[model samples]
Target: MNVSIPTLEQFREESRAGRLAGRVRLQLPCNLTDFPAEIFSLADSLEILDLSGNALSRLPDRLPELRKLKILFCSDNHFTELPRVLGQCKNLSMIGFRNNRITHIAPEALPPLLRWLILTGNQLSALPSELGHRPYLQKLMVAGNRLQALPQELSLCKNLELLRIAANRFDVLPEVLFKLPRLSWLSYSGNPFCSHNEQTALADTPVKQIPWSSLSLQQKLGEGASGVIYQAVWQSVTPIPVAVKLFKGELTSDGLPISEMAACMRAGIHPNLIKVLGKIGDHPEGVNGLVMSLVDASYRNLAGPPSFASCTRDVYDDDLRLSFSEMLSIVSGIAGVAQQVHANGIMHGDLYAHNILLGQNGDALLGDFGAACFKPTAAAHSHALEKIEVRAFGYLLEELLERYEGEATAGATFATLTHLTALRDACLHIDPTQRPVFTEVVARIRTA
Candidate 1:
């Protein structure tokens, strides 16, 4: 309602002097100067308070005075860590500290009643072990961080229903996570381990052994605009894992013979992509279903909030992040595999994170050639499209690394940005005559 500091201060002073307001929602102007510490004066009646977007560094010393506070919004601040006194706010329910420099989340720093904790777009490499100890933390958003792995302690939170840990450096997810019986919904895209391609396998890929009737289908993993993924599994399986994806849909094209979708999937084979272990031919339950490798995971959309601590309220399960090096390694590997794909004259039109697979070893595979158009003269066309694809790689790299100027290295957060940008700018020079070929990218990655 357009409140100035003076107005808010008057309430705080009056309240401390013993007055009351039903509830309070303060919106600190994004560029405001001094923070109104007086807001904490109402220790008894205040239930919900928002002090987002101000130049405040440390929280007000008297914040514990807001004994009645339930939800707090102290996002977009300069705090390195949350104040320990906040734990005293026994009535707190939800809190957001997005877009800050917070790198640590101690065990006892939070209230027991917290259910929604959002912390996206921060410098968190791994979640603190203490964080898993939260009693009522039902929803957690720790998306875009430098995490290399997940903690086993997370399974201890029996009430945790949804987990969003996308855009981290994880290659092998903790197997213990699936033990949480209440964990029904999860999104772990952008992780180096969650493979993107769930179709086709290299020559001689192992056929997955399955006891069909024992498996119960929970729900379908919508494979986005490219393919279809599923969440079905055999009963009594430890960790209750599910099949990651399946193929066998739409078979006809303009004026083309009806080979049937099942025939089309069974024809191709690649080691990196999901292998169709077995097929249930034309069953009444579904059409020509092909059994594929199980990822024990699900796909998530990247159109929601950042997964950092501050992004709690602003983000959803869909919002995920992708780092530069991870993206580059993924793209480079995909390009290498595409060399094999080009042998067959195919192009994976949608070559983004949504279509790439991060294998258990952090290797990436190209998949989802749905939009692919056949190029009979693919060998000649590769020359023209190689640089074009490289430029696309650069754009994706920018999104992966949040910076525009830095090499992709262990310390460089924005690794591919500066490296690829320089090459792309040269390749896409106004005088098309100046672009470097795809060989440069291969050479760079090899040396890096």
Candidate 2:
């Protein structure tokens, strides 16, 4: 599935020779300071254009010539402002300006059909109120910015499903966020409102400190926005094998690495959650890390990350099917873990199926704290935060039911489906106050 990238010279030569006429995608990143005029040769068919990792400050005014361009990425650039001409690209639905120097976005900078917008790691202090006018907008990632508040107009984005406003200057949680009906995933840690509580919780949590000298690193298991996980051997009395997550020491779309580490440490232990053994100490590179129990090889991710079309929802294999029991077990395990996490005053902000792992017998393990945050101290605010996550769990249940292969009109299966449907509706109640807490959700599942 890997398409070979063309070198700058090759691309130039192909375009000059009229050989790139029908190409649908183009990725040329060679430190160019200006948009390649040659790209215009494929204007008739190009749908995706990636100009990331470049030194350009502005895109060509004729960018709208590519009438078919649906996605555009201009990350890691020196753009001081979003190009105003992008609004002319009527077909553009997704735009990424991550890790850019953009400090301003004109009211007309966004395209009409925009659905997903990524402006993470920018210096913006405010956003255009025009953002709320985009009826198709679903995912908005503005983490690591300097914004003090979100425009109340954004509450009109009724279809917004995922949002990341972490590491901002907000003094309080935005009241408008509670009004979004489809906000299933959210991460707002590292802000002034709840930072003190996070530090206090981290200090109160007790954990062992494992030194780097006693560990031998092995192959890399996986990498997330905050850290790289590796399969390492802990040179303890018995030389145990464990997974070590080394923090990247940078701001991610979710938030700071330190926040994620604190949340993981505070999570403690749960039967259906990944076991954190201890924290890493005296690293050779002075990197922050955690030591966790290595998960079994038989366990695999239950689903893939969200795709362009799926927006905020996880993408499952089209042919994958699950029996009624298997689906129920996965849901039950996640519900139990969520109940325990909430009781500890933590919100697993990114509680989608992609963060869950499933074993051969349908046993589930919920991992990844990159988007988690501590709850507010106020009782009402804390309850509302848990309910926001309840909506995420409700989406998880909805996704599983779509692939359920069991009969819905027969005996126990029929009754179970009906009960689960009602529970999902309750969890997804538009009124956050009306939604049941994880404790109630777990009880209902157990009885069903």
Candidate 3:
């Protein structure tokens, strides 16, 4: 669905005629060189203000005048620093400054109520220690930066659940991250600590190489931040249909595209994973891609991506409800797949409902390697990494349980719920060492 953005002239006219008053959301992507003074008129009702794709370098000192603003996006701009006045907006909870030239953040730049913050594709060498002061922060994206370390105080953010520190200068994993109690989703693939001869890991994976001439591209099936997936026909003797994922060869909020492709190549085949058939060779545009078995048409995403309000959790359909049996099957399939993936020494970093597809009977296929990373060779590091992902699975299970419409107080259904709840608790243990391994989780779920 295309959302029509108001043109600069239209917005100016609306502001001049008092037509924008009481508007809760406003998006103006025109090549703006200045923060529109007219926006101040909507201070009474504006909650979302998107000024992305503009040429602005600074915000007015009175930005806090928009007392009701809750979300602000100024990506694709030229700002060198985060406006300190943003801290004065008591209600501002989400801020995105992606793809900006920002190199510094003032100590008072962050809002007190910040829950979601995006600084992807910035030039910052370090982050403000004051970041740890935002108790409400839950999701943070600081990929594609130059930072070598994180503030030790960040461990104080107990509610932080999802974090992306990929493509940075970290020589080792920050010890502070392990202290985050609710960190369920994490991606740190392209840093120096993990990037040493990473390609050699795929040397033993005997995946076939499928040339571009052997495939016929049809229509785009989907597109994510890293690549475009197409429904294509493999022009072999049998002309079988397949899904082709072509990488965009750029840094994403999660990590680099080459990292994702490498992870997918190393994932290999599994019943619950989208089967990777071969690596695309000799593309006309020299693009890197993967050919995978096409999923059945009946399969659909289990849930939608996180919303502005949900921040780190997936959002489900309002009418969606699952019975105990269906929920069990889905969770069981995912757990089984996760067991196999971790055994192969890969972490499905972005393990969430949005990354899962479900069939009518509740069979699940886990897709998307955009946030995946290989485990470090060290036994201790690998174990801790896997445990972090275990928490992500726990959250997924919790979400499904919340949507379960089964008989909670009855016989079999109640027993099943009790069993699953215990499994979720085990996975969500605050101490990574206490969380059950995927092997144990799979075994427990099977017995349940």
Candidate 4:
């Protein structure tokens, strides 16, 4: 049956006739100007309505009246603002708008009933405060936007489960995002601040225990070549929630399974790295697990590199300064950390903005260690570490400089450039053998 969905009105008329009740899926023109108002009133059993792949500008004004509408797909459009009519739909659970021209959203735009909201690939510079007021928001996918900062109101979301805020224009991510009690999954991949693989592991990963009354969870934080992380709480301690990482793929690159994961648990310690507090033996229910200190924060999806959707010119950060001195400070802070990794004989494979996590006290922690691999005893690992580290650091410096001096030039600042340019160039050198050692680069940065 070629159920031709002519205009929205025709679709509604057919829908009102009841034959289109369970089989109603409409594809509107890319230049569609509005939506069918009568279809919702008659289709008491309507469940899914996909209005994507269109040139629509705004959501239908009468959507709230559709008490039975469940899922709405409104991606690929020219909507500059969030439709106020959306706030009226109390039964609506999911809404998607991945590719659109939306720039700003009013604070109270979404109804408190929304559970899922997808706004990736949009022009939003920031989220509205009303987004947090939603009592049941479960998954928030705002990965590719102009967002430079997250609204402080997100902490109020008691039921937020998964959030992905990857590939954006943020240099620093706020720590408050971790305060939410129900949040468990997050990825913040491409910001300049990430470094350690977003999740850490141990020979034994501890799962924090929480009381049933406290909205606790038993979840898999995810696994890696290093280990698997789980969320749990202490049974005896009551409501003490934490993440437990159990080491796996233990065989070192040398081909011998690492016993050091256990040895290091006994010997190692660091504020930045997860602590290994010994093993809990094998679980009666299944595999062995470990106990460790739980860090206070949630996951952020902020990875990959700068894409076309990465920059947001209209999205401004008040702290932004184009001065070389300021740029130097930023570089200095990052370089200072690189110096430490070099000391520990550890090289951060992915040292970009997204991996960098700024602490509440104004310090930075390199998050996301997915590409972080142990340098083997082989010559290839040692011979090339210097250049690899330099390239990563240099790349970060370049991004900062470009962002700071948007449309401006390094002209007349030759003195400053002259001082750090050699080091920068050395870091960016194609031939790893030509780059300066980490210590040497640090000395030059301080001297400059």
Candidate 5:
């Protein structure tokens, strides 16, 4: 949450240095119309350059001079097109231009070694096939765009693990997308593929609707890309403290807030899932909200979100290690929740470690339905979609194994770990049909 924004004075000081010990990071927020020419002086060692929150329209043509530059952030800028000079940066791997007016991306604008690319909230309707050439590309975020279809060549990005193509105009799911080997996390909601009637059908369901006037908002608990969560006390005959999520009520990178609310309501109650108390109604600001049980303070995020280097995969602290039993308990709980949610004709599209909460004893609760989608149970592809999420679970299991690092291998523990490894492999098979369903996964883990 805390971003370090450098000042012009710091860059001047580094410029004064004879380039031997020049600063490697130059982050400035000054509003300007052009790139500073002096920045090229430290091109030898510059690694990260943040020119976000500026009025720049294009980058300098000689950007490739920065031989060591790796990360570039130019979000919240004025631009009608992505600067083609970006593709010339040999060492650049990460490019972020979120919340821009970019509508066109030149065919040569994508760096060859690109690993993580973020172009959220843009006006792009199409992308060039050159994007498919980036062999190392992993995380691609293009949500909130005007895209109607994805470039078929993008399927060549075999390493892509996480993708966000939601809030677009696509009429159907891209078949090539399902062929990716490492696609574990995805969000394609709010497109033509989603039906508004799925939520309209629940209009008269037997669920309580709590008015906003009867609740007293308290301290904030957490927040995500979709909404902000706060602690609140619902005043009834007997007052009760609960968690309230007041949505921003805007089209997020995933989808509309209403769709998320419908998915949460449909999820209902499960032991390993957050219990929805009711829906907030009659708000003063007309903001959409939800009421849910307040989780205990002991619960913490299981792992951190993906980093720039580990794109599309969760990152964990080196010291964080769970016991064999604890890891099994957490995985089993999540698998059970997956089975229950899929049974209710719902797909938890954004299943990742960061969205999971873990108690001290490693009991897991799956939360966050922003990327969830409601699918018809009789739909032909419903089963296939469920298998795709099983791949996400396999990815989580792999991350847990990496964190453990074979440090807790006792007699029985080692045997259990071996079985878990096989299970993960089976779930991560290249062909979706080869993967076992959540019900089978739960049964296998229970017997192990």
Candidate 6:
């Protein structure tokens, strides 16, 4: 799955042999200060173009020459604004400008068919109303900005499913957002909706804090927007093995690391969750961290992250198919975990196939509390927020059905899949009040 990136020399050789003209992908990092005119020759067939890790300031006016280009990545660039020329790319749908100095976006800068847009880690205070008119805009990442409010027009994007607006200056989430038909995945932590009391709760909670000096760090297991996770040995009296997450402590696209730590501790341990052992204490650099039980090696991610074309949905392999029994078990396990976490006054904000780890016989564990938020157990909107998460669960269930092979066989497995699909549709209703709560979802799946 690792595609080697062609170097400048390799591209030059290919260009000389007339090979570049027919190629579908062109990726290079040549520290460009201006657009590469050489790419225009391949305009007839080019589909994906990656010029990331460059010093480019602006795109050329003739960028529309690449009529077939659909995906463009300009991340880690020096652009002060998103190039308006991008709108001219008639076929361009997915555009990424992450980690740029971009502060301005022209009204017509977006392509007409944009489905996925990544503008993370930028300096934008506002977005153009024209953006809301893109009917196909499904995935949007505007985290790490200084925005005070979202354009109500964005609610008009009925197909929008995944949205990241964390670490912004918003005092309240727009009411229009809650009514979007397909807004299943969302992150609004670090906004004013996140309670100030949650910060005090973490400090006042009576959880055990383990000293950092007592642990020996080993190989890194994984990493995310907030922190790096490592396989470490807790040098206790018995020298036990454990997983340690060292938080960067910076405001991430999801929220603050401290908030994630507090939410994880408050979630408490459940059979289908990653068990938190304690908090890391007395680090030399004073970094916030958490110690948790190491997950077994037999577990692996259920699916890959969303692709450019899928927008908000996770991508599964063509051969990845699950049986009726396995599908039911995984769904029930996750629903049970969500129900428990909600009862403890926490919402796992980022629930997706990528966050789930599957073991032998479909045992599932839901991890990654980076996007989790603390909710008042009796708040009026608490029920609505939980229902929003249920819609996310419906999306997950629908993906499972898409990969299920039982429908064609037409038997008990097919019947069961059909019933579950009905439940998923009910959960995904546009009206939040109509969707079943996690407890109800669990009970229905269990009875089946």
lDDT of model number 1: 0.51
Measured with C-alpha atoms, the lDDT of residue 183 in candidate 6 is 82
Off by over 4 Å in 3: 1-6, 202-204, 408-412
Residue lDDT tens for model 3, 1-448: 2122557787888788876667888899888999888889988988999999999899998998998999999999999998888999999999999999999999899999999999999999999889899999999999999999999989989999999999999998888877888888999889998886347654556788898999999999999999999999998879999999999999999998888888887777788999999998789899999999999899999999999888888999999999777898999999999989888888888999999999977899999989888777788877888888999999999999999986689877787789999999999998878998899999998877
Cα error of candidate 5 at position 84, Å: 0.7
All candidates: CA RMSD in angstroms? 20.3, 1.5, 1.7, 18.3, 2.6, 2.7
How many clashing pairs per prediction, in order?
23, 0, 0, 49, 0, 0
- 1-448 per-residue lDDT for model 6 (tens digits): 2122446666667677776667788787877777757788888988999999988898999999999999999999998999999988889999999989999999778999898888988999998888889999988888788888888898889888878887778776567667677887777666666656467558866678898889999999999978999999998878999999999987676677877888888887788999888898798998989999999999999988877667777887778888777788899999999999888777788899989999987799998888887764556667877888899999889888777656545676666677788999988898878999999999888766
Query: Model 2: which ten-residue window has the lowest total lDDT?
Result: 1-10
What are the lDDT scores of the predictions, listed in order?
Answer: 0.51, 0.90, 0.89, 0.57, 0.83, 0.84
- Between candidates 3 and 6, the one scoring higher on TM-score is 3
> Candidate 6 at 153: error in angstroms?
0.8
Worst 10 residues of 4 by lDDT: 251-260
Q: Write out the backbone clash pairs for model 2.
A: none
Question: lDDT of model 6 at residue 296?
Answer: 98
lDDT of 1 by residue, 222-314 (tens): 654223567676554454455644444432111011111222243346654554555543345554344555642442322233232432222
lDDT by residue for model 2 (213-317), tens: 988999999988898999999999999999999999899998988888899888878888899999986888999999999999999899999987788889988
lDDT of 5 by residue, 1-448 (tens): 2234455556556567654245677777878678888788878778888899989998988899989999999999998899999989989999999889999999889988899888989999997887888889888889889998888889898888778887878887777676677777777777776666345535744568998888999999988778999999989778999999998867666666777887888886899998888887788888888899999989998988777667677877778888766788888899999999888878888899988999977799999898887764455577777888899999888888776645545777777888889999999998888899899999988877
Worst 10 residues of 1 by lDDT: 251-260
TM-scores of all candidate predictions against the true structure = 0.42, 0.97, 0.97, 0.42, 0.92, 0.92
Q: Which residue ranges in model 2 land beyond 4 Å of their true spot?
A: 1-7
| Candidate order by decreasing TM-score | 2, 3, 5, 6, 4, 1
TM-score, candidate number 3: 0.97
Which prediction has more favorable TM-score, 4 or 5? 5
